[model samples]
Target: MTTNTPLIELTAWMRGRLAERVARLIDAGHDPHTGPDLIITPLGTTGEPGTRADRSCDRCGRFVSQGCILYMITVQAAPRVLCVGGLCGACRRLEDGWQA
Candidate 1:
């Protein structure tokens, strides 16, 4: 299996977990619409080329300098398209378990 396969599965599992959490909240008589919004966004991959001076790495929370290579992560769920954040090269690899 490819590296992306596991990441994809992990995201799917997270979606299920989110659903369960929402169900529990509803069962406890909480107003669904009043509760915090639940969003399931897609994972970002490394190797894409981009640069952002004002963005921080989503995983490591480190600021990337201007002209530095960064990865753009976009999450798509139904009608929502969230352009989450950029990931530094190191964090991006670590996120995918590509680093030891």
Candidate 2:
């Protein structure tokens, strides 16, 4: 019989890694509230420390200014307090591993 190649093992490992990441995000997504990592920018307002809008993409980790896929992460204590993108569709695709 022909031997299975290392490619299969690599693919499996990659898939497993990706699946774990997705699962973590899903759990975070299922959270009902969010309030961490805020920057509250306006001196003393809830908007001051800023929000996840202040954070960047989970993939590229940079400021988003293109109105792309905004991931709603609810893993804290307030809703609408986090985001992942204003990325262009291309970058968004990349963030999603080109297949999300």
Highest lDDT: give the candidate number.
1
- Which digits, one per residue and each the tens of the lDDT, describe model 1 over residues 60-83? 657777778768754332222222
Model 2 / residue 86 / CA error / Å: 9.3
> For residue 11, what is the lDDT in candidate 2?
34
The local distance difference test score of each candidate is 0.49, 0.35
- lDDT (Cα, tens digit) per residue for candidate 2, span 4-70: 2222222343344344444454576643234343411111112222465443443344544545454
**Deviation of model 1 at 19, angstroms:** 9.0
TM-score of each: 0.41, 0.25
Cα RMSD (Å) per model? Answer: 9.6, 14.1
